[model samples]
Target chain A: MPLVDSVLAQYFEDALKRADAMAPDYALLWQSLQAATYGGKRLRPALVLSAYAGLGGPDPAEAAEVAAAFELLHTALVLHDDVIDRDFKRRGVPNLAGAYRSRAAGRGVPLEEAAHRGQSAAVIAGDLALTGAYRLVAASDLPGELRLRLLEELDAAVFASAGGEQLDVEFSLPGRRPSLQEVLQMSRLKTAVYSFEAPLRAGALLAGAAGREVEAVGTAGRYIGTAYQLVDDLLGMFGDEELTGKSNVGDLAEGKCTPLIAYARLCPEWQELAGLLGGTPSAAEVRRARNLLEECGARGYVEDLVECYAARARAVLAEAALPAALLAELDGLLERAVQRSR
Target chain B: MPLVDSVLAQYFEDALKRADAMAPDYALLWQSLQAATYGGKRLRPALVLSAYAGLGGPDPAEAAEVAAAFELLHTALVLHDDVIDRDFKRRGVPNLAGAYRSRAAGRGVPLEEAAHRGQSAAVIAGDLALTGAYRLVAASDLPGELRLRLLEELDAAVFASAGGEQLDVEFSLPGRRPSLQEVLQMSRLKTAVYSFEAPLRAGALLAGAAGREVEAVGTAGRYIGTAYQLVDDLLGMFGDEELTGKSNVGDLAEGKCTPLIAYARLCPEWQELAGLLGGTPSAAEVRRARNLLEECGARGYVEDLVECYAARARAVLAEAALPAALLAELDGLLERAVQRSR
Candidate 1:
């Protein structure tokens, strides 16, 4: 296994142990947290550790904690994001809200009451995870100045993410579809920076990397992060639901102003596509929409965009004055990310 | 005007400037924020600056920023809390959610959609305020260690606040009347600590006060905070809406499990009180319930409790090794706080 992969595995194990220690009751909250933490691919954490190592960060164990903090934060975001998006399933299983609703129903609460209870519980759980994320970072033995800077970065990313979410929600309204540039800007703010750039830059900052070396990591992160989000957009519309562990074409139903949608809007024939967006759509309608997107060459356009970002990421990595081995590993990861089917 | 009051005023102006600078074009968000920030009584900031001066802290300007940060955080909390509580009015004006809802309705959205949009906007707005609070603290010229410790305390208080909210929500359910001790615990965690103790202690910390000095503020803060909460509880039950700037009897309608309710639950004729406690009582029912509370001596009992806390606060202030003038000012504030009808 690559060094970053090993670091990530170790970090995951340690994070689970820390979470267990923090919530000893092993109550429903802990159980739901464990399920959420273990469900996703550890892409964000891996990015953090990889960037750390590539920038000469020593001691994988210490770097792992930084990685773990990002994962915990991500888990909190995903849990609360699911609630905001009104999603019922995640990772092919009942999400926190769905599980809590079922538990409340089992206790014989009215359905509406149960749902309210579930949402309330999920909100609190997300908050706990957020606190837990900070505690992890604070407890790390990193230098005080470095830790503070990392924390400040994390805080800024959180605000940016919330801003992007607000814009996304607003853009879902009829006649409110943002421009393609705006959609990409929102995606970069909401996902790319936090998911890839911030964590990576934070890891590098922790390692005392500075000057051009630090700038290099940031540049590389931007490219990789943008590519990661473009791939995610493609997956949302085209990937297998069974493998992605989320609803395929659900973004279309939700009228998400993704790059694909933005590209489709450019075609005269796709003007009617706007009416089909928003609210839940049937499987057949989703299929028809998918065909429409393909007919407009939107899917191909997004794929080309993803590849362009991927190549940019590789070029940045190559130009960076890091270890060749580490750069190669990151290059391989970027290639896999863009090419992955699920 | 008192020195601390002037200092805090300047800080509020600066903090508002900083927040405005961060988002110049976000007119709706900024307008709503201005309304929320300017609506409150500025009690929390007053307490923080007062406590800092009482402890003989230097640089009241820096102390004022710390104070303003706490108040900003409190504003954020109130905005979100109103949404959670489904409150329509605050300080005799439509709150952020209500105002947003009205705007949405004016734009021709359905009532329910308008309500949801209002809520979503409020949530995001509150989030921005919360982030703005931390930004204020982080950007302050305080000592690094003190800033870090203050940030940690703020983070912990946020977690406690969220936990307390969950407990409050849980206690509202049928057959779950918590004990008076539990109510106090929740109050301390949710309101007292964050509203008074943490901010005061943080101000002291930023001033480079010794541990003993900080501990003294904490001791005094506990009593003052308890008394403050007691007054809040009383205001919820009996204060005039115009004076208090809150809806009369709304707490009772929302089934708030306050100390007053806990005391009422202890009466021998508690069954009648219980029936009237959590329900939306009519005007006659509210009058009768008020009569029952007075007849059962619950009101007097809570008043005596407030007096006891007030006395303890004075004693702690005397015991603390601080300037006599500052102590006298704090003492005067505590007495006025207890005496305030609202």
Candidate 2:
């Protein structure tokens, strides 16, 4: 585990202790939250730490704190996103929300009531994580000025993410099909900025990097994040469940409007079948839909777009003044983002 | 309106303009949030301003920003609370969450789907507000140290409130009724501190009030807030709709284990009727419930608790070194908290 991960581990241990000491009501919630922080790429926080070190900043401690903050923010957003989407699984396992829902059922709460309790717990759990993210930064030993600026960055991400979330939800409504352009924009706003731009820029800001350097990192993150989303869109449809750790057919069943689906809608070969996207198709129907998507060249189109973003990321690296170590790391990230099977 | 209220009004006007410029997806949400801010007594924000002035803070601009922040926090929590409680109305009107739900229904969306969308919108809307509240303070003109310390205060409130919210949900579960001691702690954590302690301390901190003065304001806020919740419990059961602007039977129908109900559970006169507290009683049953409550003297017990809190607030006022102007404003606030028919 990295520095930020260790810090996060210690943070949760102490936090859960305090919360439990305060009231036993939140014990399960705290435990679920702990489980949530256990795995993942830790990508966002890594970006924070990398950016801070890359920019020649003196405070690894502050960078670690900020990194943990990003992770918490991501956790809260993902938790809430699952609730809105009614998803019960993440990374091939029951997520924090799912765990609560399952617990309620295991305890013999009726289905609807159990679901309600699960959602309630998840909502409150997410609320705790969201505030905890801000609390991490607020309690950091960093000078007040540094912490304030970082908070401003954090807030900007939250604001932009809200707009993105609104767009995502609005576009996903039944019988509401958004344009390809809108999907791309929403993708950038909803995922790319927060995942890529926020962590990278936050790191740079902590390092006291120049405005231009921070802007360059943002551009790099945008391209990289967009590429990553494109790949995710691919994996959701074509990847194996064993590798992706997801049902893979969920995007189709949930009627998620992804770049692949949006582009497929524009293709004459797939346009006729596009209406079946969210009809909760059977397993056989999903396979047929997947085959059609691939045969119609929609997958190719998305792959090409992913390449475009990857190339743009390279272009940014060529021009940015970031450290060599940072550039090498970003290159590796880009490779993983665009080429990962999962 | 007071200076803080006007400032809040202007702030929203500008914020709405900016949000509209960014995206139309949030237009309805922003409008409803603006509506929610209107027509209230502006109690929490008023406390912020009062505490700031009482602490001899010269910058009304900073005070106004903090006041608006408190109002935003309150609005967000209330919106989410309604979702958790499944209430659709607030202040005799369709609140932000209710507005979305109603609009969806009006558009002929199916009942279940529309309700889902409404809840989804409310969740996101509240998230936006919560993040927006932090943004306000982060973007304030206060010095870094002051803002940092203020954020510590803010984070503490959010942390405590989250625990309080969890306690509230757990206690309200179908078969579990909280003890009177737990109820009082919940009331203090959920209402008193955030509504009273937080804003008051925030303002005092911004004004650079001495530690003792800040502590004094916290004590004053606690007593006042406790009294306010007690009155709220009373009004929920006994107050009229025309004055209280709510379906007073809701507290009983929802089986809210308020202090009154807790105490009444021990009273022999109400033991048989106590089981009906959360049974979604009919209009006549509600009437009978009310009369029984009064007859058993449960109302008097709650009234006595309210009086005790009021006296404590008065005692804090007598000892606190707050300015005379602030003391007068607090006196008026205390009167409203305990004496208002609503």
DockQ of each candidate relative to the true complex: 0.26, 0.50
lDDT per residue for candidate 1 within B1-342, as digits (tens), equals 244345445545654464344333234555677678777777877767766776766767767666777777787778767656766577667888898778777767788777766666666676666655665666566766777787776765675576566566556665566888878777766677778778778867866778887877777777888888888888888888778766658777876888888888899756787677656799988888888888888888889889989988888878876678667777877877798743
lDDT (0 to 1) per candidate: 0.72, 0.80
Fnat for every candidate? 0.15, 0.42
How much is A66 displaced in model 2, in angstroms? 1.2
In model 2, which regions exceed 4 Å deviation? A106-108, A138-148, A268-275, B1-18, B106-108, B269-271
Model 2: per-residue Cα lDDT over B61-156, one tens digit each: 768877888888888788777777776777777666677777777767777777777777777777877776776776677877788788777776
B119 Cα displacement, candidate 1 (Å): 2.5
Q: List clashing residue pairs in candidate 1.
A: none
Of the candidates shown, which would achieve the greatest DockQ relative to the real structure?
2
Per-model TM against the reference: 0.87, 0.93
Which 10-residue window in model 2 chain A sums to the lowest lDDT?
Answer: A270-279
